[model samples]
Target: MLMDDDLFSSRPEDPLASLARQDLDPLSQHELDERIAALEAEIARVRAHSEAVAKHRSAADALFKR
Candidate 1:
């Protein structure tokens, strides 16, 4: 099951969050580790994307100001 931690964390009022809070089948140690790794990679990717977008916006704003 591909779980998106960001989506899950962001929507506290979502029904899925309620389900997630309930005690359910747990992931194996290996699966847990893999999920953590994937989340970390996703966080890095998102950070990089945000940085690039900020850089582009800053450049555009500078050109407009000149």
Candidate 2:
């Protein structure tokens, strides 16, 4: 899900925004299924990255606080 801020960001065009706006009507059921699978994989990848970044930030904050 995209926040309003993400949609209105200064970048010329975000790929995720473009992907969200893409027409899905023309896709066949198989293609839609494949697309969903790909998106799920991407979500998993992002979640892992987010967790790693949070862990790193926490470590840095702890070090700086001490």
Candidate 3:
């Protein structure tokens, strides 16, 4: 049976943070490792998005500057 930790994690300032954080005491070392991996993946995704948005904004500003 899949528990909540198997289905969820805490990180990245998402709507998940609006909800109460789950207790970490019940997690095993393996589960904590998995959570770390998930958060890392999310960080990469967010960085990529930020980079793209910054590039687009820069281009827009240059266009308007001309």
Q: Which stretches of candidate 1 lie over 4 Å from their true place?
A: 1-25
What CA RMSD would candidate 1 show? 10.1
Q: After superposition, how far is residue 40 of candidate 2 from its true place, in Å?
A: 0.5
TM-score for each prediction? Answer: 0.62, 0.78, 0.70
What TM-score would candidate 3 get against the native? 0.70
The number of the candidate with the highest TM-score is 2
Task: Give the residue spans of candidate 2 off by over 4 A.
Answer: 1-12
Better of 1 and 3 by lDDT: 3
Return the lDDT, model 3, position 16. Answer: 71
Candidate 1, residues 18-66, lDDT tens digits: the string is 7458653578889778867977898899999999999999999999995
Residue pairs with backbone overlap in model 2:
none
Ranking by TM-score: 2, 3, 1
lDDT per residue for candidate 2 within 1-66, as digits (tens), equals 999989897768778999999999999999999999999999999999999999999999999995
Model 3 C-alpha lDDT per residue in residues 15-51, reported as the tens digit of each score: 6774348788998999989988998899899999999
Looking at model 1, residue 40 earns an lDDT score of 86
